[model samples]
Target: MMKTPRSFDHIDTWVFDLDNTLYPHHVNLWQQVDARIGAFVSNWLKVSPADARKIQKDYYLRYGTTMRGMMTEHGVRADDYLAYVHEIDHSPLEPNPAMGAAITGLRGRKLILTNGSTDHAGKVLERLGLTSHFEAVFDIIAAELEPKPAPQTYQKFLKRHDVDPASAAMFEDLARNLVVPHQIGMTTVLVVPDGSQEVVREDWELEGRDASHVDCVTDDLTGFLQGLGAKS
Candidate 1:
């Protein structure tokens, strides 16, 4: 477990990553998206499902996102790709009362930072009954198609929201993506997925010394905030 930084008192705005961070990964929303991508790849490339999966993984690894790879290599349009991938029904997502309460508990302007389109983010928020918790949803479209891990994207987001980096917190499921915000002095929290046995890797630690900015790492959102003395 990592220790919480004493400088965390400066964090005031809380930016959350939608999708897997808002809900547990076990809900299988990404599994549905993965299947859709595989099918699209199989049909478009005329390959077997297994072969298509391998190709998709190859693209995802080569480009930060498979859509980026497709656009670069095959000239796939970004809008169409994002629409197809996010078309999965989100009715299966049940709201976590605990998460709802936790979001309400965190004192600050709450915003959603996502690579997904705003429409997709709205659907997910509605599904999780968390639409009211966020002051606004910042999507890939709003960021001019730049995604997370891109320093410019983070800069644009903070500027648009008038968020002070020294007074903000970003909670995300992806450890690598958290690096940019952590570097900019935002309190970073890594939400470990349930049932995952792998130890949480510290991006800053992996780079060298402990990240002077990262604040906490935990699987339980509510418990973590409660420990932080956040009040509803």
Candidate 2:
């Protein structure tokens, strides 16, 4: 419940991370991607599921993303990895009219900034019934496969999109990912898991609870947006 940035009124471009940031973490849609990554690693390395799981997480820690580590260490193709990992049933996600209306009511441009591929972002937005709200999606592939928390990728995204960081507000589920954005002067909001749901995941997923560079922490995105007051 830390005070959100008072400069929120200055935001002209809203940047949001896809995945758990957009959807309720309780839905566990990421479980499918996590499992697929483990399976891909297991099959590619000819290792047991337990060993593959370890390697997958190890890479995720070492590199910003498992795919990045795999590419650097194992010469894995980016296309292959992204395609393989994103193959999941997105049906678990339910559309939120409240969220859609809230986002629609917000002033200025809305963009999706995600480590996931454009296709994955599109599908998630579609499932959430928010496809039309976003002006553009800056995906991992668009960032030259470099993931968030990487300064270069953020720089590139800003330059490519003509976004002024100071006038932007970013929403992300991962706290670490918000560090660079905050450092670069964007208002950072951390989307926490719903208190009512059970969450089982990695250590990094839980790391941002400390709220280092986080300006705001909210489990209710729709309500948060609704409470932001009417657009100017």
The weakest ten consecutive residues by lDDT in model 2 span 1-10
What C-alpha lDDT do the candidate models reach, one value each? 0.77, 0.89
Q: Which tens-of-lDDT digit does each residue in 15-91 have in candidate 1? A: 99886788776676877877888888787789999998888888766565677677788888888889888889897
Candidate 1 residue pairs that clash? 12-167
* TM agreement with the true structure for every prediction: 0.85, 0.96
Q: How close is candidate 1 to the true structure, as a TM-score?
A: 0.85
Best by TM-score: 2
Point to the candidate with the largest lDDT.
2
Question: Where does candidate 2 stray beyond 4 Å?
Answer: 1-6
